[model samples]
Target: MHHVTQIKEFKVIDTCRDAVVINTNIDDYKAHAHFADIRGALECISLINRGLLPKSRYYKTACKRLLTPEQYEGLVERTKEKYININKGVRR
Candidate 1:
């Protein structure tokens, strides 16, 4: 698989087109602990900061960051059983 270099990353992802257009007041993945948890290194941030992790890692990071250690092992399992509902899809 190919990955982008940081110096050239900006060129690949343009903000004018990728910005979130959802309601600011609503709590989506950004507000949920899941986001921070999934984004391994970004676990320290509590509030929102733009362009934290690469777009590719968003949903995996969300699943990791928000869930507890115990939950991580079970989340996907629960999802398979239709017990967990995650909005892993990107917001339009």
Candidate 2:
């Protein structure tokens, strides 16, 4: 028997002095979003982490800092579970 695991990871695909692009890994088409800066990008990530925003939609960034390491890890775990439950009804 074999067991397979799927890891959902987001990547920062591009960065510039005034903007950054991150591949959010939530869409089948590999959707990416643009932010004015790293702080903005991280803020979007944080909102997604907290469940305050929906994963299937693109969001604009706000002027805020990233979450703490511990906070982020906890949120990631919760988000993963939520995503799994949400996908249970859909056949892939």
**Each model's TM-score?**
0.23, 0.39
Candidate 2 lDDT tens digits, 7-81: 234454334444443344334342445565656566666565454543433452221122223333444322553
Angstrom error of the Cα, residue 66, model 1: value is 0.6
What Cα-based lDDT does every candidate model obtain?
Answer: 0.32, 0.42
Candidate 1: tens digits of C-alpha lDDT, residues 1-92: 22221221111111322322222233444423222222332321211223222234564454344344454455322113456547776577
Worst 10 residues of 2 by lDDT: 60-69
Model 1: how far is 84 from its true place, Å? 28
lDDT of 2 at 43: 60
Off by over 4 Å in 2: 1-8, 17-21, 24-30, 54-92
List candidate 1 stretches off by more than 4 Å: 1-56, 77-92
